[model samples]
Target: MKAEKDKIVSLHYTLTDDGGVTLDSSRGREPLSYLHGHGNIIRGLEAALEGNEAGFSSSVQVVPADGYGEYNPQAVFEVPREQFPPNETIQVGMQVQGESPDGVLNFTVLAVNEKGVVLDANHPMAGKNLNFEVEVLEVRDATAQELSHGHVHPHGHDH
Candidate 1:
């Protein structure tokens, strides 16, 4: 089978940045599986995998716009220290979640001080080009449940 819409594609991938630093990998772990053409992975990688069959291997470069998206300066701001839980220690690089008009927003603490904490809402990888070394391990028709859920469901699992 080939990777296409509604199909389940399993692959082992090593993701790196333009600097060639590995950001993630599936080696030594169970192959990652996702429903193809369902926004389950980065757009560029997904597009590149289209029509590929099991055992296909390739290196794909994805721009920031197609990967995590360009960094937004407006996403960085300072919030008063009191906004965080009183018992929690605010530290740089800590991930924090808060309610926003659109929904819950996750931000990374860039700095901490007496008055406020600086947080950046951009994804950690935002603005960086992503390079992926991928090997497709399996391709098969997605189960009806998996299609309905918009994700892959492993055997004997409810979610």
Candidate 2:
């Protein structure tokens, strides 16, 4: 059946950044399944899936405004390294939750120094265009429980 509101749609997708680096993919594995028009995927991709059918393959580019969002310089800051537990092996690429001017936020450790640490709060993919290659694998009516739960229910699921 054609994908539409409340339908359960399964698709294999490869999500990449503007740099053409693979960010995520559904291959050699189960196709991602979710209730159509249920905010189960990125807005741009979800909109593109509307009215599509099984075996439909296409590519879509999602802008920061629609994907994650632009990077805010104000979100990155250097803070006293002492705040983190000593001997914790502070290292680049590690993630640490910290309190920011706005609220608690997740920050990726960009650098570490005796004076402080560099934290970037922007999403790893923020400020970039996201490219998505999608192939619809299946589309069928969603079970009542799937609609109620706002997700796809496995075959013969209790719900």
Candidate 3:
């Protein structure tokens, strides 16, 4: 089967950054499976995998735009410490969620002091190019339930 819309594609991948640092890998773990043509995987990687079949192996480079997206400096802002839970220990690198007009917003604490707390809402991988070495292991038609859910359902799943 070919990796295409409504198909389940299973693959093992090693992801790296521009500096050759290993970001993630499927070695010693179950190969990742996702529904093709959905938003289950990064856009660039999904695009690269389209039309491929099992046993295909290739290296793909995905720019920030096609991955997490470009980092926006404006996404970083400051809010009063009182906005957080009173008992919560606000610290650098801590992640927090807040409500916005758009919906729930995730922020990473950048700084904490008497002045205020600095938070950055940009995704951690934003602005970084993703390098992926992938080996396609299997490709098959997605189950009807998976198509309806817009994702791949695990084997022996209830849903």
Candidate 4:
């Protein structure tokens, strides 16, 4: 059956960046499955998979706006390491959840120094063009249980 909103969709996908770096793939494994139109995948990908049938394959380029989002310059900040819990080891490239006056946010450590740590709140995929090679393996109407639970169950079994 063709994929439709609220149905179950299963697909194998290979994702890459503009530089041709392989970001992720579903090869040599079970195809990923999820409920359609439930925010289970990126917006651009979900739109591409809509109405697709089993065995359909396509390549698509997803822009920053639809993939992750444009990098926000204001999300970068420098704060003293002492501001964190005593047990935490602050290091560059490490990801941490920071609680601000605004709200809790996930940020990546870009640089570290004796004076402070530099953190960036932008998502890793932000500001990048994504390329996807997707193949629809199956499309089926979602079960009543799955619809009620707001997710697709594997093999139509209870989750």
Best by TM-score: 1
Write the residue-wise lDDT of candidate 2 on 4-24 in tens digits. Answer: 999999999998877888989
Candidate 2 or 1, higher lDDT: 1
Question: What Cα-based lDDT does every candidate model obtain?
Answer: 0.93, 0.87, 0.94, 0.90
lDDT of 3 at 97: 94
lDDT of 4 by residue, 1-159 (tens): 988888899999999999899999999988899999888888988998888899999999999999899989998999987988777788889999977799998999999887888999999999999899999999988889988998988876765
Which residue pairs show backbone clashes in model 3?
none
Error of 4 at 107 (Å): 1.3
TM-score of each: 0.96, 0.86, 0.95, 0.90
**Cα-lDDT of candidate 4:** 0.90
| Residue-pair clash count for candidate 3 | 0
**Candidates' RMSD to native:** 1.1, 2.5, 1.1, 2.0
Residues 1-159 of candidate 1 have per-residue lDDT tens digits of 889999999999999888899999999999999999999899999999999999899999999999999999999999999998888898999999999799999899999999999999999999999999999999999888898888998673785
- Cand. 4 TM to true fold: 0.90
| Candidate 3 Cα RMSD (Å) | 1.1
Evaluate model 3: give its TM-score: 0.95
Candidate 1 weakest ten by summed lDDT: 150-159
Which pairs clash inside model 2? none
